[model samples]
Target: MSYLFIILLAAVLVYIIFFRKKVVKAAEIAGVNYDELLDVHVPFYRFLELNEKNRFEKRVREFFREVRIEGVGTEVTDVDRVLIAASAVIPIFGFPEWKYKNLTNVILYPDTFDGEFQFEGGNRNILGMVGSGYMNGQMLLSRAALVRGFSSAAGKENTAIHEFVHLLDKSDGATDGVPANLQPPAFAAPWLHLMHVEMRRISAGKSDINPYALTNEAEFFAVAAEYFFEKPRQLQQKHPELYASLSSIFGQDPADGGGR
Candidate 1:
């Protein structure tokens, strides 16, 4: 029955265009089967208290209804939809009414893509990307990378979540490491300084953070976020200062394994 529902659901959603990024409110999206999908893929949703779980589901449904997710040269399963929605919801769960006002559509490629958005052929190294310029208001994800992020084989990296954090960082009208709109004004300076310190540690190979974070403050923020959410306990133990600061920034204390 769940399989049948997913097949039907995918059929309906696959044809959905951007439609101005509106929340269609077209009948309902997530349900028992979606819950099962979340339970299987998303650890954050599984750990939520019963009430919080319902709220999480509600947010996921809203995002699923709002964003137009279409496949490019691949088939999108319910698993992909749920995982993508979960990625969007988990970061902003602290802000109940928050929505991705900037993003209207998400394109799923069969695998990693190159700069030109070509998923096949050599040099296809990009796992996920948030678009800009003529391509603004869109996001792209590698299906394989998306699934791997939620699978048992996943480590501290979650490609979908990383891209969402990038969107969050860009929310304050700037792509700088400091999310002025997300974090308190006073903390912006400190956050920038902290990013520098952490980037140096990563550069020196003295940190567990991905070296890619050293690319810039923006990348640092996104990379650290993946670490924060993926292994909160480990982050808390190994990098308590980072954990505390991130908890404040995101309004989420995942280290405690509970919702805000």
Candidate 2:
């Protein structure tokens, strides 16, 4: 009986290994070509300029190679191209584990899509949303919103960054914005304390963080992520302690790219 069980386990392991390999191959076949991806989603020349300015071109290319873009509606535009580039590149500066051989499908929407929400009493309402990201999974975006967010990094909130942050937080299991994979042992006390403090401050309307963060721990993590990447200098300058906590967690420095 034991021998039979061992044989069955070995067969199951082999089957799982084969299945995973097949799935990865299929994903590779469906992946967009590098040149084509650059043309349709982000112009190669523009990326070159960004790379030159930031000295992160090779890293950016490596990151995009792992992502797969899927256009949903009409042909992808120049604006769509730029936004996708930003989505693929910026996150990696903070989350290096994202390179772990997976496909992130980029879904484009012509405009804001209707998102339905049901309340406790069974009342439903539709809300217009620009974009959302699933953990290490897919990203949905609206061309118009993407343009606006990229054009004015200071004013318009970036939904792509916001949603992707949620995914990062969900890496551990729950979407509470505290990804278990990235959490360092040394940061446990400071992270918890500062997060609680910031949450309370936001709740009291004393923080620059979006009011949305006060909604929950997950939203707090997501909203903080948007600010961390988009307004790194400002966040670090104004909230050094909070920035320190974030830096410790992500193991990257946005404010000058040095260890905090």
Put down candidate 1 lDDT per residue, 1-260, tens digits, no spaces.
Answer: 69999998887776564332343334325343777888877999988888988999889878977788889999877788888899999889998978899999999999999999998889999999999999999999999999998877777899999999999988877888888877668998888888888888887889998898988888888899998888899888888989999999889988787521
RMSD of 1: 8.3
| lDDT string, candidate 2, 126-150, tens digits | 1112233443365566666666555
Cα shift from native, residue 167, model 2 (Å): 2.0
RMSD (Å) of each candidate, 1 decimal: 8.3, 8.0
Best by lDDT: 1
- How many clashes in each structure? 0, 1
Winner by TM-score:
1
Model 2 segments beyond 4 Å from truth? 1-55, 94-97, 100-103, 116-136, 257-260
Alpha-carbon TM-score of each model against the true structure: 0.88, 0.65
